[model samples]
Target: MPRSFDEILDQAAVPDTVTDADLDALKQEIVRDVTATLMFGARPAPEGRYPTTLDRAEAALTALCAELIHSTDAAEHLARIADLPIDADGALHFGCLLNLAQEPDGALWWWQFAAGAGNATAAYCLYLYHLFHGELRDADHWAHEALSLDTDIHLTSPAPCRRRKLDSPPEVLREAIERLKVDEVAGAQFHHPDHRLADQIEELADAC
Candidate 1:
């Protein structure tokens, strides 16, 4: 039997014991650095794709559709979802799918829209996006912003079943930043050298 979307994700979820090295390896294998593998619809890779990314996000969409409409037809779901008003989850996964289809700017735009609506997961997605591009200042701001928002977060797909719950946003974000946190170290390579960069970035963020 084809597993329900939630079942598929339960099998793919990153366990608590998933180390940084494991995440790094999975990130490398799943998608390019510009996006996050932990985002909605990014996991439960098909059996034998060499790169493991769904081509054009097709398989990922089908899996999500199964739960979305009680059917696994991507075209049908796409049409219906498009006709409805998009919310935080809708925007988040739309962006994920766009990034998966190699349209990163489109993904960023959608994520931005969702983040503006106070979606913490979208904020974290921005954090990952900036961090991958070496924009540590922007990454820091989004990381902080995500922490301040609602902690119980979920992906924008598969209807967020308990069977496929995500790691709390704070948990994953903290883990990511801990390694890059510069306060304890005099000189960290990936982090900005200036201690005051975060304040400056915060102010800049306000004007945006």
Candidate 2:
């Protein structure tokens, strides 16, 4: 049988010879690896780029939680994980908390918190959520914010999840509509009466 999260933590052994700095570094590396592997299927370089197994991914997360629980410098650890000053990786970590919740409301709270802290991935997820819910204006705004950080970026849930239809990078869809001629791109789809130049903001949620 697979070990439970607590069991995995109980099994983790740190040598007396390992310095705190090294332990901290190890914790950071593990968090980064699990996040990239689970979320985007990307591997941190100098390592092979392959998806992490479910058991190993869970173990990494459980170990990181254990590290936080036992960390002597709690403030520094908190600062590192909270995506302070807009670190995209840190934001993604917080977003993982949503998957652990019983309902999306709780997850949205955390995602919003992370997005407010300038986590672009969180904002992008919010954009998708709003789009799925048919809230065009809100979706358009968050999508813009998300694209500002990385045009080529594509986000996916780390695991099988609901409301996961946003597969293309927002910039891709935006560029497609940009190629339309002046006469063809008119009307509510191209121009919102409330905000000019907001082309395809309304139609995209329905079409996609």
Query: Which candidate number would show the highest TM-score if scored against the true structure?
Result: 1
Q: TM-scores, in order shown?
A: 0.37, 0.32
| lDDT tens digits by residue: candidate 1, 1-208 | 7789999999898878978999998886545423434443344346565433323233333233223223233233233334542566556554544443334465567677678888887676777676556354676687788778768653335322222222332332233233333332323222211222222222322221
Model 2 TM-score?
0.32
Q: CA shift at 159, candidate 2, in angstroms?
A: 13
Give candidate 1 misplaced runs (Cα > 4 Å).
Answer: 1-81, 155-208
- List, residue by residue over 1-208, the lDDT tens digit for candidate 2: 9889998876795646988999999997687556545544655455256423433333333333223223344333234543342444433443332222222453355456667766676676667566444344676687788777666543432553223223342453344334432222222122111111123333322232
Candidate 1 residue pairs in backbone clash: none
Question: What's the distance in Å from true for residue 59, model 2?
Answer: 25
* After superposition, candidate 2 runs with Cα above 4 Å error: 1-88, 152-154, 157-208
Local distance difference test, each candidate: 0.47, 0.44
